[model samples]
Target chain A: MMRALSWQSLVAVLLLLAALFQLPLANVPIAMTAPAVAWTTLILVYGFLLAGIGADTFMRSRLWRGIVLFLCAHLATVFLFTLISDENGLARPGFYVVLAACWLLAWRCVEILSGLQPRSRAGRIILALIIPAIFGAWILIIWEAVTRGLGIPFILLPPPSAVFTKLIFSLSVIAADVNQTIFKAVLAGYLMGCASGFVAAILADRFPFMRRGLLPIGNLVSALPMIGIAPIMVMWFGFDWQSKAAVVVIMTFFPMLVNTVAGLAVTSTMERDLMRTYAAGYWQTLFKLRLPAAGPFVFNALKINSTLALIGAIVAEFFGTPVVGMGFRISTEVGRMNVDMVWAEIAVAAIIGSLFYGGVALVERAVTFWHPSFRNGKA
Target chain B: MSEARGNRIIPVLVMLIAIVAIWYAGTYFMNAPFQRDLDRRAGVTRSSGDLFIATMTQPKPTLPAPHQVATNFFENTFLRKITSNRSLIYHAGVTLSSTLLGFVIGTVLGILIAVGIVHFTSLDRSLMPWIIASQTIPILALAPMIIVVLAAVNLTGLLPKALISTYLSFFPVAVGMVKGLRSPEIINLDLMHTYHASKAQTFWKLRLPASVPFLFASMKVAIAASLVGAIVGELPTGAVAGIGSKLLAGSYYSQTIDMFAALVAGSLVAVLLVTAVDVVGAIVQRRMGARPS
Candidate 1:
């Protein structure tokens, strides 16, 4: 029966048993430590997690069970944080006990969230978003707790709190980096790359010979270390956003080209014959039938390029840049051991990357609403 | 069949010629400004044809012609001893080691994670979401930090760089494996149930075989990603070895021909790695009683 429990639960239980055996929570002097704060928090955390596990096992109504588990997990987190802060910069059995119990409850909360089979599309989407958010938040919490508790050197990894603080403080600097990298380089390059690739796909499609020939070459180029060209691009375009944009263009082009060609080729002979029967011109058929059918594939490439473009722009900045870009900031700051600023830049990149990908995805869903995946309301 | 194959080959050959022609023209035009300036400085009156020829032969032109890059590639790869640091082959070897090591580590970790996620409902619920969320982050953006931090801990060299590749490769493999392992049809699973097959039997005989094609496809993606990771890994470290450093050196010294050659060498390595995987995948598929398609 215990084997059925998540690893977090098993570990938490063992830690609790060790706590009962009178292990000191930290290396602090016995007279200076209240110690009861740690033990009491551990007990409360364990109790809440146990309740969550029981709710999952015996509960019938999925929604209520989820609520109970979430509540239990959150309450456990609250107590756990209090316990952790009081015992900060110290490692002890009791400290781990609190953390382990909280983690166990989080595991149960996630289990409940994943098992939820919501009927409404809204509920399903909300659940999908919440589960991942909760998961990400848990990782942040653990990173914060462990880094603070162990007093890990900031250079190795700044606590998420410090990173957050730095993020707020350095908003302008981060904004400059984002403006230079995303707005100037990434956006310009991504548009040029995708548009050019789309045009090239049309050109290739005009010649079936070129379509077949270019397809394999496109795939090969897509898989190559295209990012290595950043240096040469910088040399050609000068040390400005244009060079980075050039790198992004090269990085993004092949994926879009390959995907677009494949997408254009998706139409069948029967479909083409039907268009012929309707007396539709080649351009008209392409625009009406084949292009619409290729929506998913086109959007797939767009989504892929969104990430590729950002990465290309940033990495290109590493080779040479105009004193202000994400890659420049990261490379320079790491040299200065300003680790928090580095984290801030990374956080900004992550948030922007997510937004860019998410924006593309939203457009895809709206544009390709007639696609079969959309019809089934599935990802 | 022979005619169809010939049709494909002939078009590719024609396209290759077109690409080279376009590349040479682009180089001439791009280097024209620099070439004309050089000629004016030398007090020489040259025709457009002379200028075009001059652009193609410049020691450090803005854009090297394809032939220049080819010559540089041949010199660096074949002329130099394979053991020498100047050899492109040696640099490629340095990068390839980390790529293969990282790919192996990533594949193992991915398969293990997939197995756990597939067998345990709880892990699937917990881990799968995190895995998807992790992808939203521009992971390679953190590569420099990863290298620097590990360097601080006195853990230098291949391990640190290889970890980056491992991180990059693991996600695709994990996502692919999970899908592959769960791909058994409902009817097939029901048949196994009627036969009283144990979980182990069902997994080995049914899920394992079913996952082979997916595994190969994901591995192709994974190995390609791994090479990219390995190349990028060498960038921030100021390492004197590897293709990335060659790229760095080329840029620093403004050696356009050499830089272009390194890029080509990187591409060659990528092509070789991908083709190896494709060949192995085909063999495995045939051995598994699957038709070639």
Candidate 2:
């Protein structure tokens, strides 16, 4: 019995206490303002959850806990939104009870999922996917509820829903920003920067003395706030995507150089001797062993540069632009007090960044499939 | 030993000279067109030697010569009052304060969170994914919004900038420290268990010491990131001072030389911050009876 007293239970107990002492859920009871169907559903879900709490450990199965959690979270969301819709009504303690209960129940679900060791491969994948989904979903729910229920000024943080609505409506605008920043500047700069860096690394490898001399400098350059050169690049190129692309190129260059050089250096003397024994020429060993081994390192630089390029291209727009870019929109929209539009741009950037990173990571997995991290199919 | 050091030093020196030479040549070529346009306007032809010197001396040459930037860097950094807005040191100090403040706050928060994650399996499972995801979401996009909103609330100045810095610097330390805290070998864990050491004792006596190197390494990365955040934070705010504002002001007025100087000073600050971390890390490592690295 003592073993069953998890943090989840303690949180639930605290939430229950809050609910018992609940003031008006809003300025008025949720029922008078909310539709019958919504309040009735919320009541049904909470009642079911309360009944489960009354039962022994809410069932010993993962599926049941997940269902209760899902139902509880969804209806609690419903309850919170219905209360929020009554715009003039201020939330009282009762609004928090639903939020707290939903969060705690989600916590319990993730905790169970954390301990889950489903024997089947497909079951494992689903479990792995569901845990993070619940965690992320709850975060959005909390953000929405607090923003709407507490009536946080929209300029401070438009609720995720409003931001999404803005996003849906402004698809054309976002697509233009994407084309200007990602498709044009980032892509051009990334390809040029990475290719040049890779070439420089290979060239430097031929001269051991130059390699030693350059490596430390390269490391230093990599660590510098390379973004500071955005203005200079803007000056050199112009007030357009070309300038942003130039910034991205310079931004991506050093990291790739440093990482690729280090990767090339990883071919130890023992490996070189083995290659020599095979009567392989310098080019042969490099292409066969060194470059293959450098794939992971090269891919690491790629991953870093992908994020760096996005940031560079966008921030460079802050300097000057042709009136269309993620950075331009964000800076302009904020001044216009179009906070929702700003957030929508941020969301688009987040999605583009994730896709770019995910794509690079996928290629890395396929290329470096022989690396130790991937050898056992580790996540 | 000296000969080996010489071998390493010579190549670097050569590379430096080569880069400078290239810079000088590049300046001549890039700025030559501008100089020709000037000469064409003035209705005079200059010899190539005279033309090269003219291009290098252009007040707003398309690409300033290395010497122009060096002189500008020197005058702003050393020849001016440190308190003056025209001084690079003044701007750097402004940027550095937020960087340090943010770095300190971020390091503390990160180390605490890392400790929690290390001790709690549930946290490790739930939080690690998000920590990684947080990094992928370019927080810089929000910098402009953060500054504006905070300004609207009358919460301007160092705090807003520091908050951005804090968010930027937090991830590296947390990620590194988590790996560090969990780095003690299984054999060491067994030894602790055999002695009946409590979790607190084990953490203090074994885990904490073991994490110092990792802490300092990530601190270096975190500090650099903090500087970047501090610098960028100033950009959207239309700030009156700081390295970022200096860059913004320079760009606005086309003070190409001042912009280059600020860029240099910013990079110098980055180098110094990283070196300071390295030195402190070394001292800490030595005090902990580790071999000098």
Candidate 3:
């Protein structure tokens, strides 16, 4: 029989010891009558710890261990919600117990997840998605409990609950901002900027003069603090999506140019000689051989520009805008002390930015399938 | 080599001339509307040459000529006292100090977190994705909130800006270092295991050394990004100092030339900062017995 002497058991024992102390869960005394949730949560966690400590060999399998640890985590999270109320602050000792319990449980979960080897493709896919989701959810839960429990001022940090509530209620505003920032400015500028850069890179490859003169200037321009150009763009294009799009264009163009140029340079002289021996015309060689080889680098630029376009659009909106945009709302809302709305806008931007980046990365994986980095099945 | 350099110079010079010509033409085109309006109000139509001159020399043209920006840059950087508020160098210093502080803090934090992630398999699975997700959030969107929140706590000036820079720059370093630390071959790791080397010794002797090149590369990106963070931080604070403020003030007053001058200064700072990191990296590599490639 196992000694139950693992770090996992050790942590459970330490938590068990800590639970015997009759300390308040928070700084302020919680309403005595409302202790049902707290008591149930505590009992569940204690029960899980006991079971984990006493479980037999079969229960020690990766799957069984993962389920037990996750159950403990769920109970502990519920305990946190109970402990962290508006009238209560974290009691140092109780907080420590909760933290240790969660850390150990999370570590156990990680161990199990890493060890488990699913044979089926669908199982692997589901497992992959579930791991990060749980991790992300735990982060949000912790954020919510700590902020709400500590009674941090809304101005400082609106609790995640409040932020989510604001987001749900303010859908119209967020939709409008996304339409303005993403659909108009980000989309337009991303296309124009990346397209122009690609064309310019191709032309530069054709002419030594253009490459010599333009690449250095492009480097200098790309390094220009993009935000600094927003105000000037506003002056030039007036207060609309036009100005924001201009900023995005300026921000994204050079990265694409530089990356594409570098991508073009990646072709080996030996490869070029082979193409020449085949008597392939310049365009034929470029399209068939050189361009295909440059897929990874070109996709790298695309991914980088995807994020840049979003940022440029949002930051440019800070300078000037007409009525609706993410940056406009953020800038204006903060002035009115509508901090929740600012957070809501930030949430919207974060979600959209992630989606935009993910979309590009998905495309990259498909297009650059032959690249060595993608060949490992790791992605 | 010299002949190749000469050949490159001629094309580059020709391209430079072409760009200048384009700039002059763009300036004339952009400023023509204003110039034509002025001429119309004055009840006199000037020749094309005179109109071009007027466009180039306009006090507050829509698009300033290259020479006008040069003059503005020269006047701000060289003509003014370094201590003066109008001086570009003074503003750059303010921005640079915050950026440097933030970059240093970020580098340390990044290295520490990278070490944690590499050592703790749990962190690798759990925290790595969050770290990447954190960056995709466009922290600049939250800059105003950060500034206001910090101000509520009576923390102002460089600290808040530095905090923003830290948020930005730490990611690149952490990601880079994770790759670096994991870069050591399995054979090398097996050797360490056979030697019965402790974790700390293995880390110090093998992983840390392997991570040096990655750390420097990340630092270069981080430093440049930290400057962007500093500049963005300066924007919302409405501060009376820094390059960001200069851009803001210039925008408020429609001083396009002044804004362009600040842009030039910011770019120069970025280039210099990156080069500085590269130089230090080369020196470190040499001292570490890595040949200069």
Candidate 4:
């Protein structure tokens, strides 16, 4: 039986076939003659497309499709690297046609593989990882192709290849910057700010007057931009990580305070009445019921503060710094036209910020496993 | 209900009074160092009562009394011409225009992308992660790069700043709208299909209306972010006008009192912008036949 085909898959297959015979799929305006490297890469790309088509027609299983997609993605990367070496100024119509075809087919493979319902947990996890991996790889492939093909200046927009090279070459510099900003400023500020906020929130809960007084003031103070207070902090604490830490503290404190206070109030009257009937004191009730009830809200603040702390520390470094942090590197390097270094720093920020947020989320999962939102199978 | 409302107001008033008193005390303590230093340098023997008055009334206070900032706000806003570079009103206008422009651009871009993501399942999986990734890269870190790159292209002033604002503001709208567009009941969607509604018609008749509340909520967040973007954008350009420039100038001069006044002014602007959005949201919702929540 002929399996019914979707329109996108059909179009993708047709275009792949068309790419097989197209001569000079891309033209390099900058190069007087097409280099052997470009020709070789193009042939290899076409060859991979042919293989992809073969797999699409012959194989229906998710495993084969996923493996073929990865191979094709790798081929695309090789093609981009070669094109950059050839100094291609612009991509011709044929190049775009082939690119679109490859993209569509890759997307199609991803769609099918994602749709597959793996029976085992391990299989499911593998499928989940494979899907986003392909998706993210395509983004890089597309970005690389566009920038290289258009001959965009490195200063305006550097290719991911250049960015990756910078990241590898300048590992020490990036590591030092991360150590200064994230380890020193972010960690110090996050712990102190969150601890103080949590303590203050508990105290506020015990005193109605403090709760009423503090919340409104916190709300107003939270709205004050970091820029306004950062220079002042520098004035007070000197131009080191301490000032940045102060900025982070101010940025982070109110959010935790507000969220924790709200979380503490979330225990319903019925729960309190039940606790009273059980003859539990405030401390016992708080430890057993109220604090546990507040876990999700407290986690929400922690997650929010993770990003805020990084942002506050980095932004504060813009005003005053010891020339060793991410923000300082970016500001100073941008002036020197070293856009690649800035992007490398950005990549570092993205990775660390993501890991920090992920770590908090993982902890939240463990702590708030009983939250209604976590009732689904996901952890 | 009225009694409960009155009870709540009493605590809030008491809290406000207590805070103001604490603030005055804090100012007295913080500004004393400068006052004491001045007194020592001038070899002036001042009484404790006179020192307290000196701290509160210093022209360049280390920590300005609330009344001092208020007086500065009044004088700078009303005494100076609105067009003068010295006036806070003038600087605020520059910041506000860029903020408004950026907010509009970001809102439009966000809605368009959200529609695309909602319509195309592939884009939802692929593009959403990148969008989220874009935000996690601190915009402050990117702001300088954007300013320099745009300057190379001979693009400057409002457009560049507005673009930065767009960068900051678009995420909330896109994220909120995605959730909002998908918020309609499945039964309602099925009913639309039973009526043989086309995709466009269904989107227009059901999804768009359902997303209004979400759009407004996200707009509030977007507007505030846009303001921050506008301020950060001004910083990189060394712009002569804007609330950001005012802050920078104050810091450069070590005029702590003036810096605090500018900070207060900036916060007030943010609050006003959010309130304005709320008012507009209420008006739009009322006209749309949705009962006020």
- The candidates' DockQ values read 0.70, 0.75, 0.68, 0.53
lDDT (0 to 1) per candidate? 0.86, 0.85, 0.84, 0.83
Question: Lowest summed lDDT over 10 consecutive residues: which window, candidate 1 chain A?
Answer: A1-10
Q: Per-residue lDDT for A1-379 in model 3, tens only?
A: 4544667657767886875684555554644555565666567656765664554223646677777767766666665566555463454566657555665666667667756788998977776766777778877776776666666777887877888899999898899989998999999999999999999999999987789878877776666576689999999999999999898888888999998988998999999999999999999999999889888888988888888888888888888899999999999999999998999899888998888888988888888887878776664
Interface RMSD values for all candidates: 1.5, 1.2, 1.7, 2.1
lDDT of 4 at B89: 91
DockQ of 2: 0.75
Best candidate (score: TM-score): 2
Query: Between candidates 3 and 4, which one is better according to lDDT?
Result: 3
Rank order by lDDT, top first? 1, 2, 3, 4
Candidate 4 residue lDDT tens string, B1-293: 99888776777788888878998999999889888999999999899999999999988776789898888888888899999888989998999999999999999999999999899765776678777767766767788888898999999889899999999899999999998999999999999999999999999999999999999999998998898888878877885789888877877887777777788778888889988998999999999998877
Per-residue lDDT tens digits for candidate 2, residues A98-201, read: 66876776677677667777889898878766777777787888788778778788888898998999999999999998898889999999999999988888
lDDT of 4 at A260: 95
The C-alpha RMSD in Å for every predicted model, in order, reads: 2.8, 2.2, 2.5, 2.8
- Once fitted onto the true fold, the runs of candidate 2 whose alpha carbons sit more than 4 angstroms away are A1-5, A28-42, A51-56, A86-89, A377-379
Candidate 1 DockQ, CA atoms = 0.70
The residue-by-residue lDDT of candidate 1 on A1-379, one tens digit each, is 1226555556656766766664555555444666777678667876887787676566778688778878887787777666546444766656666566667767767776788789998998898777767777788888987887787888999889889999998889889889999999999999999999989998999989888788888988988988899988898888899999999988888988899888988989999999999999989999999999888999999988998898899889888999999999999998899999999999889888888988999999999998887787655
For model 3 chain B, give the 10-residue run with minimal summed lDDT.
B121-130
Model 4: CA > 4 A from native: A1-39, A86-93, A224-226, A377-379
Clashing pairs in 2: none
